[model samples]
Target: MKAHNSKKVIQYSYLFHKIGILDDEQYKQIEEYHGLKEKKKY
Candidate 1:
């Protein structure tokens, strides 16, 4: 469930960024944070 939600979040974040809702920094922040968490778990 968590992993699924994380994927959705990343997808949405990218979509938002692509559509001009989120900037590069904001998108990268979210992506990096989740990437770190996933790394820590694995």
Candidate 2:
């Protein structure tokens, strides 16, 4: 269950990153804040 939620978060983050909504640093900060273990390789 937790893994599913994390995957959704990652998907949203990736979409935001691609759309220029969030910069690289901001994305990293969000991932860190969420304690995401698997970092997406832009």
Candidate 3:
């Protein structure tokens, strides 16, 4: 539905803006940490 898709777009934009505040180094570190956690879980 159009409304459902619009809601998803808003959520994605919100997340993007939230992460946009972080510097690239911080983002990469967070990503790496999550990757390690995922590997451990598997």
Backbone clashes for every candidate come to: 0, 0, 0
Off by over 4 Å in 1: none
lDDT of 3 by residue, 1-42 (tens): 544554465555556657796556765665565556555655
Tens-place lDDT per residue, model 2, 1-42, is 665677678779979999999999988886785555544422
TM-scores of the candidates in the order shown: 0.83, 0.63, 0.51
Candidate 2 colliding pairs, count? 0
* Top lDDT model: 1
lDDT of each: 0.86, 0.74, 0.57
Query: How should the candidates be ordered by TM-score, best one leading?
Result: 1, 2, 3
Give the local distance difference test score of model 1. Answer: 0.86
RMSD, model 2, all Cα superposed? Answer: 5.6
- Candidate number with the higher TM-score (1 or 2): 1
Which regions in candidate 3 have their CA more than 4 angstroms from the true location? 1-19
As a TM-score, model 2 comes out at: 0.63
